[model samples]
Target: MTATPPHQHDVVIMGGGLAGLTLALQLKRRFADIDVVVLERRAHPVPHAAHKVGESSVEIGAHYFDTVLGLRPHMHGAQLRKFGFRFFFSEGRRDIDQVTEVGASRYLSVPSYQIDRGIFENYLGEEAARNGVRFVDSAMVRSLELAEDAHQPHRIEWSQEGKTHTVHARWLVDACGRAGMLKRKLGLAQANAHDCNAVWFRIGDRITIDDWSDDPAWRARCEPRARWLSTNHLVGAGYWVWLIPLASGSHSVGIVADPRLHPLDTMDTFDKAMQWFQTWQPRLYDELDGKRHLLQDFAFFRNFSYGCKQVFSGKRWALTGEAGLFLDPFYSPGSDFIAVGNTYITDLIAHDRAGHALEARAQLYDQIYHSFYESTLALYTDQYPLFGDPEVLPVKVIWDYTYYWGVLSQIFFQQRLTDMAVLGSLREELQDCQRLNFAVQDFLRAWSGVSRRRNRPVMLDQAALPWFAELNRSLNDRLDDEAFKARMRASAERLRALAMEILERARHDNPTLAAGELGTLLAEKPARLRSDAPSEAMLFEPG
Candidate 1:
């Protein structure tokens, strides 16, 4: 059955997820005269299940939504507040919880919010509607036809109630989440180099916390704190489970693992995943002993690519959010990246409408976005083994810098487009670091060799301290004033100096010193220096 064509609009956005909605809102705010229509396959008032995954929001993401998108009221109402992240790890007899306190912390320590995507998306949808975005629900877009000339308009053919319809617009946006609907239609199904997938479901009434304290004040403080029981059990092999709390008193529990270890076809899906959870994390299993019930079966996907090669091909179309770049959820970057993409795309669209050269601006945007995603992907994937290892001290240090970098980048640096350019250059250095594939096993072997003997010979002495201090001062002056950033950069410089000193001293003290050991020691420069330094100084030192 043929359906009538709707009136042409200035912009047509495909997919009604958070990314799509955000772009629509930004576009409306930027170009009020341009008509924007969003096509979503789901029905209005989308029925979203509780305890679905992705409940955590970083501080930067929240600020963008509240401040940039102008949705503070909606966010405040639906979002669950969170202080900076707390990482727990143990080394022999010592245990550490890395906590970044608000205000004193480098990143905006404003608590991030944990929100149910279902509830959050609904609110965003409504908010977009209020901003004059016309939503076409339960509308499945079949294909897109690009116009031959830049002046000609693009066309989208879609269906509803078994009938067909066509919509024309100057711009078409593909914000479809993971499905990559538009991307697939255009034959852009590039597999992510990293083979990772996740399976998640909601657990209701299966987990409960009870306070036994008799003191009223203690109980009052303990009860509320106890409610925040979201936990991540980091089992090795690129597998981890996340337990997040929702306002409905349910927990969002899921397992993210590499397909190589736990193939989807072999496991019983939910039952096997739950059984593994029960065996590995007994404490959580015990908590849910009498309280837990499964809400749904698991959902899985692999080849989660970092960025699309062609996010924006011309003035007529642009991709935003997951459609453009889908980074791993290891650090909860999904929402933040979406907000940033929307902001940039809309800003460019606004400029183009003002008779500016939007094509050139869009090309620049695509270049920066791709570079950012590639760098991020390389950074995480290369460090995958490091993060997977609970004992790697260097991993902890990198994470400390990462946490603060996210804060500083979002709050201060990301605001300036130029900063992103500088950041892009930094990523090039990181790419080189990743290509080395510094495995954990190699590091541990070297550490064992060095720390094994009790009477280990000192290669350098107090006499060399002057040179080290001088080198440190030189590097310190060049670093950003942030305590953490300066310390990290200085630490790197110290290692380089220490490596040279070690080789020079070894050559002078013992002419027969093995070249292999010197090479090994040199290779271990940065991490070795970081580990040997006093606990209070390095970024990764556990507090």
Candidate 2:
């Protein structure tokens, strides 16, 4: 343990979880002369296999880890390359191929990973320290002394090895995750409308989902590569079960559901989760029944989604990761938020160090970050039931993926988080997209309400969709200011056309349905996919 003395640091970060460690590394990487200290309550070398629940990474998170932090070597070596997201709408039946599935036939150019949190986080902590960050483990923060004045440095008091130590910092960031030390103390927690819960556990042996089927054609769908490497989800109504493989010969099985549908008590415990699986996911239950004794750990959170009233402050304090806000794990956006939040925080710190106007920038970042949070929340708020409908869910997934890849992914990939000029130029377009998103979310709920659960044995290959695959691969392309703006404008138009498609589909299902903001837009300007562009009519049509 490092000796602590009322030390003065350029930045002091709390809770050395994924968010905290990553923030420290990012800060150190940008400003080498800056002294950063990270305080983690957990001891070093945390046990492998069952360290944490967020073991899956989507493209945003993976790119952040690989390109942003320049840790591709560690990611490729320590983590399992994700084989894209595979979903089984089989519900109860063990015949996976017989049930309708939504996934990629081949891996997309964009990369993600099935992260073993234990291994990944451990590496992050070590990497942070190795890269000139003072990462202190076995730390328990007892009190915080946040500076009220703009030019004052914040103060932190923590305990390590039964010794109380004090540190002063120009910036104090809360990356402590759910502990939310600053959030609780400052009363920044704001309850979101998205009330969902999750329960998950890891097993000692691998749960090879591919072996569940014996059909030669089924096995041949994705050949040579192992399906177990993919982050598999057995999706059903109001809940989805995730099967993530760990590098340490273990499988992470999780049940994330809407409490309104699947009561928390029904599957809070390991035994109850197993029994719940028996009813909804018999194959997984059957696999775990024999190895119940080898249960490594069990955890559950009721109403995990939340919003923060304030995270970025002009007072030289900020929050990142779960310490500030978290939307959902369905798309594995935890690490992505860390990347974004850290990016904004770093920009603010850079401006402050250079004695530029920070209050305006801070307020702008606050609005932008929270807006991103709200946009993401729209996808999940009261949208869990759609997970069960094989038909509607596939379309919803495509829409969601398009929105994700089109707008947000482009901003981050092109490194435009703090570009005020670009953001201002696209303000009207973004506002329209937001309104369209709200309308489409409501449409999806309404459509799912009236939709039928058709479980046809059709494999909707996301990679086969040329536009969709191109979107994934296009992230690597280098674009200039003009090209970037053009790309964003194109994405916005795509969303507008998509809104029209969703509206038509909704009206097709329910002739008496009324339109909202999107409806008005569609009324003024109809959603017209280009002649060569893919149309929704045949994508999810009766296959």
Candidate 3:
């Protein structure tokens, strides 16, 4: 008698968390007739707010979720709209209002959100199933047999309810996050130079920053008095504390620090974290002193930032999300990278469906994706020392956002991530911007070394900068080909000018400031420099 044949599908996604489920939804939307199955380890209806740590979204991730996936209604309805990133240099102080504050006075044109991962994932599961994706929760992937030939289908075996099942698929994806099912199996794991540790927890009650201060002027700095809505960062020498509001009425708090200055052993537990906070951040300690019982969860990770050797392959299998690579969470880039990886994988699968050559496309996409990773990695590596330097940090934040919005965000927003010709044309400009960023990060570190670490009382409002605000608003513009190219050229000039300005300011503060390539990079003038160069007012001035 012949045995029963395994079920067949076009795609089989392992570990149906954020990356896998979202990828499933994207594939179904991109190709309605494609057969896709997502195997998830955890059961459905997971608890909200306390489920995960990455609950923040920036521009690229927000656009991917809202516009790309058409989930704006759900996001707007369920998640809290972020006011923008707010930073306070209030280390070891109880009076946060007197600290040098850096943030927008109002919301930026481009929107982001404080996500409740559990809430969003549950919705995604339902949505994917509704759209014909076979989302099997509480299903554990037992084994995988990747096909060597492009013509053959990969086989996957999973167990659900103590019953084993097998399926064959043309494409396989490992979105298992840090579990890295395929990455481990293929020896694709790699470590990064950044050796920072992180500890995060969620409190059942809302911990509002707005209520921390009673001063009228401080409360009125942000329009509508919604500072609580922002992703607030409390920065110090080797660490930063984050306070993010969740839609489920819980507050997420975290401490991310370089182990050299702040060892993980110090704040690895609830009681220890409170003691550490008392010495480093007295105001936060005071708030949580009596509310220890409101704590819903606690977790920590050593050296959270990592790199994957290879995420995409011509062998019909790919890894997305934490299963692949992860950069720093300072800018909340976890979801942004997720969006990027998912897009690349979807494009590769599309190539396979069209009977096109997968080897070349896979190689090119891998290069471009890793290039992006390295570019972003420069922002965090060896930069924690400057977290407490109020003067330099405000300047660094402006430059960082400029680079993000001007270059990388443009490629993504214009749907040009996979456009080889456009990318080829802008390669020089992108490289210049990247080189400048490296120099700038080094430049900032050097600047901080000589910094006075000024803790002023003024609020450095980003929205007040007209050109800066305009650059952010440009994300919404749907530009034609010529317009997009022109925009990129303008962005290149904008970044060059900003870099020159930052270098000049650093030198102005300390004549012996050391920065490599900044002077030479700013010297080369292919395009005319903008007449409206960034001024000293862009930075926080010494009183």
- TM-score (C-alpha, index-matched) for candidate 3: 0.97
Compose the digit string of candidate 1's lDDT tens values, residues 1-543: 134645677789998888898888878776777789999888777545452356777645766777767878777776656433323221111111211111111112244576767787787788788888988789898878877887788888899978888888877888877677667767665555766667777766424322322444433432254434433333333455565666555567766666666565543366666566565544455555555455543565555544576776656677777776677766677777776677676766667566666666678777766655654555355344333343342333332233324323332333544344454545433332322223322333233233211211111111123332332223213234354343434344443433344344333434554545335545654443444343323222221
TM-score of each: 0.72, 0.96, 0.97
Give model 3 RMSD, 1 decimal: 1.8
**Candidate 1 weakest lDDT stretch, 10 residues:** 95-104
TM-score of 2: 0.96
User: What stretches of model 2 exceed 4 Å from their correct place?
Assistant: 1-5, 527-538
Question: Order of all candidates by TM-score, from best down to worst?
Answer: 3, 2, 1
Cα shift from native, residue 18, model 3 (Å): 0.8
Query: What range of 10 consecutive residues in model 3 has the weakest lDDT sum?
Result: 532-541
lDDT of each: 0.55, 0.86, 0.89
Q: Pick the candidate with the highest lDDT.
A: 3
On TM-score, the leading prediction is 3
Pairs that collide in candidate 2 are none
Please give, for residues 1-543, the per-residue lDDT of candidate 2 as tens digits. 333556788999998989999888888888989899999999989989999889999888889899989999988988899998888996788777799888888888999988888898899988988899998899999999888787677888889888888888999999888889899999999998999999999899999888988888888788454778888889999999999999988999999999889999999999899889889999888889999988999999998999999889877889999999989998888988888999999989999889887777888899999998998999999999999997788888888888888888999999888898987888987887777777788888877887776788878888777778888888898888888887887777788777776777767767877776667776765645555444534245544
Clashing pairs in 1: 205-291, 206-291, 206-292
